[model samples]
Target: MKPILLLFIFVSTLFATQYSVIISKKVDVGTLSAQQVRDIFLQKRHSLGNQKIIPLNLVGQEPSRIAFETDVLGMGRDRLNTYWIKQHFQGITPPITQPSHESIKAFVQNVEGAIGYIPSSMVDNSVKVLYEF
Candidate 1:
């Protein structure tokens, strides 16, 4: 590859935003493993025992969403689309989507068992961070 292309890659990676998985402060569940997060986001697992979990997604093309999907869920866009399509046939639906980090934080803060991810910088004490990446 060209030197300029390599430099661009390095710069882009250096500046990439970090993300965190957050849950409502009211949720009793503590830290979660990556597989647990993946299951929740993919709708393969619903609740942590009696407490139901509602996973939230960002609307449209958000960088955090892409990072969460790639790093946490370990799936590409096309694969995720196909997975959701197959899930639809099995009566499973995708996670609810919020327009922005603010909205996701608000929803998680207010809802009982809500869990969502946002840019690490956007997190405050209003919600509990389950994981960071």
Candidate 2:
């Protein structure tokens, strides 16, 4: 390979963060479309077939959250905030939150029906990736 190509690849790899939606190995969900994942996170739809779905979220101004919101949920922070506020009045609320990707993975691994997103590179045998962004 050419040196320029090699350098470009290295730089991109260093800066880029690939994110994915993941679930506990125990959850029986199949691959989900972006829309389905968005619904789950937004609390608009719950359960996939027989299994109940519990979505996890990263807290406040997180880069992973920003990317996931933009790429998958197709909403900005302001829009999401307004949405949740309206839902709140009707007794609906946002998903549970964890502080970091490591916490998210651990939560998914141990909690049945638990699902969340994190950096794609953080995934391991403990969790099943349902969608990527």
Candidate 3:
């Protein structure tokens, strides 16, 4: 019984996902409120002060994407898909999608005003992390 419990804990830790919200180092906005992060991702708010903000999303089916949507965006996959579809009808668009965490890091590093969430393990000095979850 103790062995089974230990295995369960190990497996749970192995599959756990940690996410960090990152912005270009050039972006002057320091840290952001959780609400602000949600708004940015949802396209409710665009620019932070004078700097134009661009949010990026990981491709569908990525665990980090799942975590970010569930935790930060406060929406599940089905609801988020529905929301974007409705926005498309209104001529509003969702954030650009990157295929991987590495791609997101590279893009955020090179693009001013870009923001994205990636696995906390992938973070480095190239971008500034604004929040973590």
lDDT of 1 by residue, 1-133 (tens): 7999999999998887888999988778888899999999999899987999899999877888888889999999999999999999999999999999999999998998999998888988888989888
TM-score, one value per model: 0.88, 0.88, 0.87
**Residue 39 displacement (Å), model 2:** 0.4
Clashing pairs in 2: none
Q: What CA root-mean-square deviation does each model show from the true structure?
A: 2.4, 3.5, 2.4
Instruction: Write candidate 2's Cα lDDT for 21-74 as tens digits.
Output: 999888777899999999999998889888888899999989989999888999
Tell me the deviation in Å of residue 73 in model 3: 0.7
Which lDDT value does model 3 have at 30?
A: 82
**Residue 129 in model 3: lDDT:** 88
| Candidate 3 lDDT by residue in tens digits, 1-133 | 9999999999998878778999988888788888999999999999999999899999879888888898999999999999999999998999999999888889899999889988889888878989998
Rank by TM-score, highest first: 1, 2, 3
Model 2 ranges with Cα > 4 A deviation: 1-15
TM-score, candidate 3, is 0.87
